[model samples]
Target: MSRLLRILFLTLLLTFTACSKDDDSEDGGTPIAGNRLSTGDSARDFLSDENFDELVIEVVYVEGYRPTDAALNNLVQFIEERCHKSAGVELNVRSFPSPNIAEFNIQQVDSIEKVMRSQYNLGDKMALYVSFLDGKFEDDSDDSVVLGAAYRNTSFVIFEETLHRFSDGINEPDRFLLESTVFRHEFAHLLGLVNLGTEMQTDHLDTENGSHCNVESCLMNYRVESGINIPGMTSEENIPELDSQCLADLRANGGK
Candidate 1:
């Protein structure tokens, strides 16, 4: 064959190979419209087209801030069951326990973001991070107790303190309920419930906080005050679930 023809053939072959690789691994998930803002609607849109491969959720915790076996199992079960039933995506969850760290005051989200990005490398999969850190989350002005924080698709719960508070003089079941409620609530945010990920077909968002739903009974309500409802935490069976509006959004946004 002529040298010129050989060069042309080589170029064609390279192009074909590149296309094949992309076809195999290209993210099948839908892209978010406009700027990638960390809004409830945007997050939902990002995960709407996740027909790619597997949905991997990484649960990380400080050595001293881990949940009980029952709590952890319940968390995994809730996540796996909900994702499979609603999103039709296969779930792969892995947990990593980091060495205990003494300081727990997170001044900003970047502190936790840095740790998450460095330790857990989530390559191309549809990934979310759940970090269990010690102490309470604080800002410059206020030092109120916080259950967790979610940005984009990552969430970290300062749960050790809260768990200790709830279980201070309670039984195992009560403690499990507290942990499970917090666990599911954070996961709900990641799922874009209550007009977070995808806009609610109806108006259920609590515009006041801009992250939680207006419904009092919904799991995404922003009233997760530490000791507000201790009696409600009496049973593990009473863990929160997504309200109908959130479920509709999930279904419309490529979830089941």
Candidate 2:
């Protein structure tokens, strides 16, 4: 129940917030590949090319901290397989040189976003940041700890020292799988899964959580009580893919 609650709180915090900076003047000029962000915008309107043939993803990690080869491979394979197999869209995943990792309070997400935009000169590509912090995230405004978050065209997955320790009973393989799952989950938000991007064709939208789907088995499900089980990691078979309704929304938005 504790893990579930933590997941729910982080999920909701992202769903209700926007990543826009205070000064648009310093915005890296070009917008992210997807659509423009606006107040109250339910879906991102992507600026996909006419053919939708390519999409770029920038992966960045804190200096001196890196995921194992297996973990990194797992993430790359998952994104490529899912995007190609489901939507027929090709992905160009670029890894950036590690930047200085910041121990950020939850309230500093906006500031972090700005720093990232400036460091990478982010424009027309999705950015994924992985941070290795020894402490849990706290909000000066509130007591809820944030584990991970995604907004606009950027997403971050932080691995806290306390959460990933071997004593926690999550081994390396398991931890990597959990990390991969969280990556996909947050990236799905950028893709506008469920009711976040496009209106659903079916009644599968979880209205209570407006940003996620009602289907419990889907990757876009509002809450993940425990981490998702993926093939080659948790299960012998069964690769994780977006549920039908969510796929339909991606298809409609030039994803394929």
Please write out the lDDT profile of model 2 over residues 144-233, one tens digit for every residue. Answer: 344455544444545443335321243223665555556666666755666665566777877887677788777777555233321235
Residues forming the 10-long window of minimal summed lDDT in candidate 1: 5-14
Runs of candidate 1 exceeding 4 Å displacement: 1-42, 45-49, 84-109, 116-124, 139-144, 168-173, 224-228
lDDT of 1 by residue, 90-156 (tens): 3333344543444344333334544443222123345455566655444311234455555444444
Residue pairs clashing in model 1 are: 29-49, 30-49, 40-196, 40-197, 41-196, 41-197, 44-197, 86-256, 87-256
What's each prediction's TM-score? 0.66, 0.64
**Given candidate 2, what's the lDDT at residue 203?**
76
Error of 1 at 16 (Å): 39
Per-candidate total of colliding backbone pairs: 9, 3
Query: Candidate 1 has what TM-score?
Result: 0.66
- The TM-score of candidate 2 is 0.64
